[model samples]
Target: MALITLTSDIGQQDFLVSAVKGQLLQINPSFNIIDVTHQLSPFNYPQSAYVSRNAIKNFPDFTFHIVMVNLFERKPQQLLLAFHKNQYILCADNGLLTMILEEKPEMVIGLKLDSNAIKNTLYCAQIFGKTIKDISEGKSLLTIGEPDVPIIEKNHLRALLGDNWMEGQIIFIDNFENVIVNITRDDFEQQRRGRSFRIVFKRDEVIDKISESYADVSEGEKLALFNSAGYLEIAINKGNAAGLFGLQGYLEQTQNAYLQNRLFYQTVKVFFE
Candidate 1:
């Protein structure tokens, strides 16, 4: 049985995920369906990308990955079936695939499915399922879909560095309220360079001092540390940092302005040195 993994924003409380699984099983009863995660934050591209990138390589070779987050956006009509490093990924033509592929794909075919014919997640069942089944049965990728357009390029998030400082935006915030910045451990170490530095968040809120581990600080105190994934994180030991500091991840000035007009809190800013 071929292993097909799913990663999506659809929560398990609803029938959306189960419905997709049912459809896939109907197509090939012997196919093994795995759920990498269904609790991904809604429309959170960076979080989804991080989880997908970390999870994909652990699965067996030839495993088919189906990404369904933000798939219905009216950006452009393009479907991506790509093979990289012996793994297959089926997703929309949006920049999601571009962020994950470490190297260029061997082939990228644009899939055109009869959108009107497939209802709901059945699009995946009919289109992606058929493709996976064919590949499992020893068919060429060229037989599935026609080439439509070359992959679109996207600008990556910027990382700015100075002699004694590095600036980066928060890329993800987990359920624990830990903030993961785009800056890596190497960036932090390079910027510190044997000098004392502090991490601040949300308009001069002294979120943390440098700490090697959570236990380095007293309970309820915030700390800046390198997480297991080698990313810099702002977290409160055994407490909710977001709630304590009234902070949310990745706020936009436009969104804050709308909120401020309604007597809500103003913008948030982060600084590190």
Candidate 2:
């Protein structure tokens, strides 16, 4: 059976998610479809890339990831099929492929879309499904897709650094309302340089040390830790940190000054001392 994972921005409130899954199953009943997530915020590329990148790395090699986020960001000309680090990713050509992979894939192909086909989520799912089926049945990737195609490139979001401080954006807020920042462990350590640091967020809240786990702190006390995905996470033991702190996830909004101030408040700043 082929292992296929689905990630999308479509919420679970409607039938579209299930309909897309049905379309995939219709193409290959033997496919083992896994849902990474469907509740990702729309057009939030940083959050999508973070979740997709972390989840894709955990799956076994050869796993097919079908990303249905931002499918109609532009007129659909082609879908991207990328083979990176022994895994396959199918996503819209909206620069998400590069963001998730953080680099060029080992190999990439452009799966052309039919101009006449109703360019909906289900149709795109069908196109991806058939391509996976063909590859599973010994079809050469190059034969079915246009190789060496130029794809849209978008850089991964990174922390903004100063001489003594680095600022990170809140990328995700989980079910428990713990906030995940974009700063990775590697980034944190390299910047720390063995100095004591303080993580400041929401203008006034602060965490001075990185804890091993949420349990390291008293219940309802805020703590900072490197999450399983190796990103910086701020949580309160058995409490809702995001809600309590009023920490909102980062959004790339630049239009309104009010939203810009809100975005600034959402950032977590680490000062090395």
Candidate 3:
């Protein structure tokens, strides 16, 4: 049986996910439906991208993963389906695809659904269900829609550097309240070669010193470190870093908020003595 995975901001408190599953089963009863995650922060694309990126590769090859966060954000009312590194992914064409792909897709196709025929989350049942059914039945992607507009490709987040610092805003706050920055560890380490740097949250609170592990600091002590996924993380040992630091992850707007009782970090200066 072909496996289909679902990830979305749709909370489990409702019947959204079940309805999608029902639609899939109706189309192809023998197919397997898996849930990667349903607790994603609402409309948070970076979090969705990060979670999907880490999760998709673990599934078997030929798995179809669907991400349905913020499907109505942009125009053209389209969805994205692509195959990358032996996995198939379906999501809105917002930067989510580009963020995860990190490069051009092996095969990229846009899915044009009858917006009128399928409205609300129920559309996943109708549109996505039909797509998956077709694919399992040996239908080509080109059979779904006409050659539509090309996909928009761009990096939504910024990378931090040692010699040249790039500003990155917090893009996600997971349920654990760990703030996920737009900056990746690679860019941070490349620019920070042994220089002392600081991460400032709201009210000018500075977090200095990178820890080798979460246990490197005593209980209630905050530390900056590279997470297992190789992303720079700001966390407190056995405590809530976001609560202690009053840091807000994923800002809705970027303005002088940095100046208004907000956190700001000095540019990481890299100098070889």
**Highest TM-score model number:** 2
Q: Give the runs in model 3 whose Cα sits over 4 Å from its true position.
A: 74-76, 147-149, 160-167, 194-196, 203-208, 252-273
Give all TM-scores, in the order shown: 0.81, 0.98, 0.82
Per-residue alpha-carbon lDDT of candidate 3 for residues 30-121, written as tens digits (9 for 90 to 100): 97888888888776656677788878878899999888877767654677778789898887777778877676788887788675664566
**Candidate 1, TM-score vs. the true structure?**
0.81
* Positional deviation of residue 75's Cα in model 3 after best superposition, in angstroms: 5.7
Model 1 accuracy (lDDT, Cα): 0.70
**Candidate number with greatest lDDT:** 2
lDDT of 2 by residue, 1-273 (tens): 889999999999989999999999999999999999999999999999999999999999999999999999999889999999999999999999988988988899999989888999999999999999999998999998999799999988889999899999999999999999999999999999999999998778888999999889898899999999999999999999989998888877544865866776678999999
Better by lDDT, candidate 2 or 1: 2
Which residue pairs show collisions in model 1?
Answer: none
If ranked by TM-score, best first, what sequence of candidates would result? Answer: 2, 3, 1
Question: Candidate 3: lDDT over CA atoms?
Answer: 0.70
The TM-score of predicted model 2 comes to 0.98
For model 2, which pairs clash? none
